[model samples]
Target: MPEVWERGADDEFAGRADDGSYDATARVVDARGVDDEQRVEAALRPKRLADFPGQPRVRDQLSLVLEAARRRDAVPDHILLSGPPGLGKTTLAMIVAAELERPIRVTSGPAIQHAGDLAAILSSLAEGEVLFLDEIHRMARPAEEMLYLAMEDFRVDVIVGKGPGATAIPLELPPFTVVGATTRAGLLPAPLRDRFGFTGHLDFYSSDDLAAILVRSARLLGVEALDDGIAEIAGRSRGTPRIANRLLRRVRDWSQVHGRGVVDLEAAHEALALFDVDVRGLDRLDRGVLELLCTRFGGGPVGLSTLAVAVGEEPDTVETVAEPYLVREGFMVRTPRGRAATALAWQHLGLTAPMDAPGAGAPQLPLDGEGRFS
Candidate 1:
C-alpha cells in the first residue's frame, strides 16, 4: 500500500506537504485514478470521434453507425462499449453524442439504486439525447429490468403506490440513444447485452498508439516533452492511455521542480522511479505479488486469497487489478491448482527458477501473433 499523507490547510495537495516536494506517499502509479482523472480528463478528451486515437476497428464501426443514423435523421442504435478500465470507453460514449450533435446525460449504474431513479431519468430525456451509463454491469436488478423496456420500446412502467395498490403507469419516452460502458461485460444480463444494437470491445493499445496519444496529450497540456520522454512514458504505461497521461503529468511536475521545466528522458525516469513504477510498469503492489510468489512460495501454486493476504490487499484487488496484467504479460499463470509464477517472473526478479518450480519445464503456449497467449 502507498503511504498516506495527512492533508493540511496550507498544503497545495493531499499528496504534497507545505514544502514543494511531493510527499512520496500518494498512489501516483495507479491506473484507476477515476477521481483524480475526472478533474483533468474532460479537457484532454477528444470531443469528436475523428479526434480520438487508437481502437481503429471500434472507431470505424462507430463512425459508420453514427453516419447511418445521421443520414436517416434518427437516433443511432444503442451502443455497448466493453473493455478494461481507462481505455476510453467513456470517451467513446461522449464522442457518440458529439458526432450525433445531441445532448448527453451521464450516469453510472451504482448511482441508479432503484427502478424509479432510472424511470425519472428516462422520462426526462429529450428525443435524440444520449444516455451514457457507465459501469452498467453493477446496476441494480430492478433498474436493469427497467432499462430493458426503456431501451427496446422507448417506454417505462413507473410504479405508483405500494403492495397490491401499486400501479405501473406506462410512461411513453422519447426516442433516444443509450451508450453503455462496462469493464466487465459478462456481468450484464444477456437480455440487456442483447438490447444493444452495436457492441464494441476495446483492446489494449500498442506502444506506437500510446506514444501518439501521449504526444497529443502533451500538446493539450502545454508540456514541452522530448520524443524520447514521450516514448519512455508510453512504454511503461501498461498499454493504458489514462496511465500514460497521469505519468506524463508526474514527469512534468518533476521537470518543473528538478529539471529546467522540460520533460525529457531523464525527467521521465526520475519521476516514474520516485512514484515506485518500474521500467516494466509494475508498481509496488504488482512487484509485491511477484516477489512473494517467487521468494516466499517457492514459485509453487498459491491460492489467490493467500497471495492477497500476504500482500495486505483484498482478494478482488489482487485478482482484478494485478492478476490480469501479470497473467497477460506472461509473468504468472493460473493453473488448475492455483496461481503460480512463471519462469519469466523469476527472470524479471533476477532469480533462477528451480527445477521443481511450477512452469519450470511447462510447455509454452502459442502466442496469438499479438505477443499474447492465444
Candidate 2:
C-alpha cells in the first residue's frame, strides 16, 4: 500500500517534476469534456446489491447473512472480498451498508499507518457502522496487528507515548462491521484472513452478465444500444462492469463524431478497434506484454522483475493489469519459480504451441461467469 496523504479534491496533481510523485488518479482531475466521461461513469456505478451485476451466488449468500445480522441488531460479521480489480468489490461494500441501512466509513489500508492512525479511525466509528477497509492486505504491520485484536475482541490496544514510557491503552470500539476488499488476498496474513466471518472470492463476470451490466449502464447513460452491440461489447469487456461501461462511453463518443445516431454493432466494433482492442478483446498493451514474454523469454519461466525490465514497465503494473487476465485466460501460469506464459498464449497471439508445453491448459472461467441474471 502507498501512503498518499489526503488532499483537497481541487488540489492540482503534483507532477513528476516535484519529488517524482506520480498521482495515478490524475486522469480524474478536473478537466473539461473528457473528464465528464469519467465523472458520468462514477454516477453510473451501482449503489445497491440488486443493481450490482455478476457474482450472484455471493450476493445472495451475503444478503441472507446481512439480514440475519440485522434481525439480531448486531454488526454483520467481518467480510473479506477478494478478486481482481474492477470486479465491483467497493460497490458490494456499499451495497452491504445499504441493505443493512447502516452508515459506511470508507478508507484504504495505506491511509492507516501507525497504530495511532488505526486508533483514530477505530475510535471514531459509530455503533453498527460499516468500516470499509479497501485493500486491507496492504495495511502496515503495526496497524494490522491492532486490527487483529479489534476484529477479534471488539477492542483496540493503542500504544500511547514512546520508548521506555510507552503504554498500551485498550479502547472499547464500536461493534461495527469491517468489509475488507483486496485484489491480493494471498498477501494477507493467516491471522487476518481467519478473522473474517465470510471470505467471498469475486470472479470475472461472464459475457451475458457483462451484457446485462452494459444494458443497465447504457440506460443510466441515456445511450440507446442494440442487443448485438451490447453482446459484442460484453464479450470484449474483459469481464468487468467498469470496462463494459468504459467501452460504451467510448462508443458513444465515436457515434457522436461519426454521425451515428446510436450505438449499433458497427459503431461499437469500430470504436473498440480504434482503441487497439481486438475481436477476442486483448488490448494492444496486453498483447505487447505477452508477445515480449513468449518471443523474448521463450514462453517464460521468467521472474517478474526480469519480465518487467523486458517490457519496460513497473513489476506491479505487469503483475496487476497484463498478468492476471493472462493467467486467468490460461495464457500464463504462476509457478513456484516464476510466471510461465502458456500454450493459450501462443494460440491467442497466433503462435504455434510447442509439442510438450508445461503451462498448456484450458480456460475455465470461474464460477462468477455463470449467468446470475438468468
Candidate 3:
C-alpha cells in the first residue's frame, strides 16, 4: 500500500507522483515508445461478474452469495478477496457493487492512516454502499482496531481530549458492505479476518482461460486476431489476464507496422521477441535468476540476498515479484538452506544440469533429435 493521493472527479481517485500530480501509468519512461506502448489496463477490465473469466470456484461461490443477498433485499456481507496482484480482486469488488445495484466508494488501506480517517469514511457511508479497501493488510494498526468495532457493531467510538481526561463518543454507522482485497492475507490478524462473512482466494488463470480472456479483450479493443495468435499470447501470459491484455496491445502494434494490420501468429511471435519474453513465459529477470542459479552457482543453494545482488534487484522485489511465480511454475525451489534452481529450469534455459545439482533426477521434457523441447 503506497500513499499516492490524487483527486479525481466526484468519488473517483487516482494515484499521484511525489510532486502531488497524476503520473502517467507506464512500465518505463524511456522515449523508446515503452511509455506509449503501455496501454491503460483498466479499459479491458470486466465490469460484470459473468464477464470475468477464470477462478471458477470463486466466481461461482460469489455469484450465489450476491444473488442470495439480492433476493433478501439487503446489503451483502463483508467479503475478503485474497490473491496476488493483477488477478482481478479489484474487479470483483466492483462487480459486487454492480450486482447489488449500489454505488461503491474506492479507497486503499494506505489512505486510512489514522483512526479518524477510518471513522470519517465509515461514518459517511450511505446505507448499502459498497466500500472497497485495496491492500487491506497494510492498514494502520489503530485503524484496524476501529474497523473491527465498525464491522461487528456498526459503530465507532471517537476518543476526545488527552491523558486521563480522554472521553469516548460513540457514533453509529449505516449498514454497508466492506469489500477488502489483499495479496498477503496471512498478515491480517485473526480478529479482523474473522469479521468477513465470506472469503475468496483468486488463483492464476489457465492457458485456455487466458486464451478466452484474450479473445474477449480483442473484441473489446476492436482488434482483429487469429486463434493461433491468441493462443501464442496466452501461452506466454504468465497466467495473468493483465499481462495477456498488455501483450495483445503490443502485438497489435507490430501487426500494424511490420505486417498486415491483424494479430496473426507471426505478429504475436515478432512482438514477443521484441519484448524479450521467452517461450515458457519467463521474462528477462525471470531467466536471469535461473541462469545465475544454474551457471554462476552450480545449480545453487544460493541465499536470496546474494541472488538478488547478482541480478541487481532488491531482495523484496525478487521475493514478491519473481520468486512466487518461479516456485509455482516449478522452475525454482526454496529450502530451509536457501534457493535452488530445478533441473527443469536448467533445461528451460537451454543448459544441462550439473551432476551434483539438487533434484538432478527430476523428469526432463521430451526432446527432439535436434535438442529442442518437444
Candidate 4:
C-alpha cells in the first residue's frame, strides 16, 4: 500500500507556519525519497531502444528520428510518449537518453510544482541531456506555461518579487531535449502538446510481441521457458510488456520454490493461478473492480468516487492502471454519466449483461474496438 501524507491538508498550507514546523517546500524536498525496490527496478530497466520490447510502431518511428538527429550532431526534437503505466514510457525515456548519447535527468510533474522548481532543474541541464518529465499533464499551470517558453525559445523569464518591483529575469537554458510522458493525453493543454516535435502513442503489444518479450526475459533471468509456456504467458499478459515481465518474475519464483530447472507449462500455470491472474489476462484486482462496478454499482452510472470506495483502489489507479486494459478488452465504457460495464465484461465474469447491453438501447461512447466491446 502507498503511504498517506498530508502535504495539502492543513494550516501548513498557510505560509506563516505558526505550528513551529518547517515550510511546505522544505518538507516537500526532504520527503522525496525512493527505496531499494525502486532502485532494483531502475537498474533492471532496458537502457536502449533495442533492449526495450513492444510498441513496434513507436520503436520504428523513433529509430528514424534518432538516425536523422545523429547525422546532424544536434539535439533531437522534443518528443512526447503517451501510454499506460508500466508499458515502457520510462524505458523509452531511458532509450532516448542512450540513443542520443546523453545523460537523462528524470522528474515528475508534481515534483516541480512551482516555476522556480522547474527553472532550477531546466537551467541546470547540460546540452543534449534528455529531460524526461513523466505524468506531465499533472504539472502546475504556472510551471507548464514557463515550460512552453523554455521549449519554444530555450529561455525562461524568472519573475522576482512583488507587484510594483517585480522584474522578469531572462535566463537562457541549454538546447536540451524534453521527453514528456503521460498516461492521459487528454489532460495536456494543446499548447503544451503542440510544442513537441514528435508524439508517440504506445499501444498495447500483440501476443507475438509479448512472446518475444518473454523470450528476452527468459534469457536475462537464465530460465528456459518452454515454447508453449511462453505462448500461454503472452496471451494472458494483458497485452503489456510490464505484465509479461512481472508474470515471468512470478514464474521464476515458482521454479525456484518447486525445484524446477525450467519454466514449463505446469510451473507457469501454477504461478499465475497463485497470483489469481486468469488465462484471459484478468487479475483479481481487475475482476474485482469490474465486478463491483457492474454488480454492486448496478452497471454503473456510478460516480468514480463511489466506485473507488466500493473497490478499495485509488481512483487514478482505476482510471489509468486498470480501466485502460478493461476498456481496451471490451469490458467497460466511460460514459458522460459514469462508467458502465459492457456485455463482454458480463460474459467474462460468467454472468449476463443488462437488457440495455450495447445496441440494445445501451449508451455507447466512441471508443476503440467497439464491435466486441458490448
User: By lDDT, who's the top model here?
Assistant: 1
RMSD of 3: 8.0
Candidate 1, residues 1-374, lDDT tens digits: the string is 34457665676567754554665555445566776567577878999898899999999999999999999999989999999999999999988988988999999999999988998899899999999999999999999999999999999988889999998889999999999999999999999999999999999999889999999999988889899999899988999999999999999999999998888999999999999898889999999999999999998699999999999999999999999999988889998888999897997899999887656788777964345678
Instruction: Assess candidate 1 and give its TM-score to the true structure.
Output: 0.87
Off by over 4 Å in 4: 1-44, 293-306, 312-317, 334-339, 352-356, 359-374
Residue-wise C-alpha lDDT for candidate 4, range 177-277, written one tens digit per residue = 99999999999999999999999999888888889888877876678889988987887887788888889878878978984767888888998999999
| C-alpha lDDT score of every prediction, in listed order | 0.90, 0.83, 0.88, 0.83
16-73: candidate 2 lDDT, tens digit per residue: 3356576565444446876876678577878777777779889888888888997988
Better of 1 and 4 by lDDT: 1
Q: What would the per-residue lDDT of candidate 3 be over residues 1-374, giving only the tens digit for each residue?
A: 34554445552545655566554551223475554344445657788999889999999999999999999998878999998888899989999999898999999999989999998899889999999999999999999999999999999999999999999999999899999999999999999999999999998888889999998889877899999999999988888888888899899989999989899999999999999887878888898999999889888899999999999999999998889989988789998879999877887888988776666886756975323589
Clashing pairs for model 1 are: none
Candidate 2: deviation at residue 354, Å? 5.0
Candidate 2 C-alpha error for residue 194, in Å:
1.8
Clashing residue pairs for model 3: none
Which is superior by lDDT, 3 or 4? 3
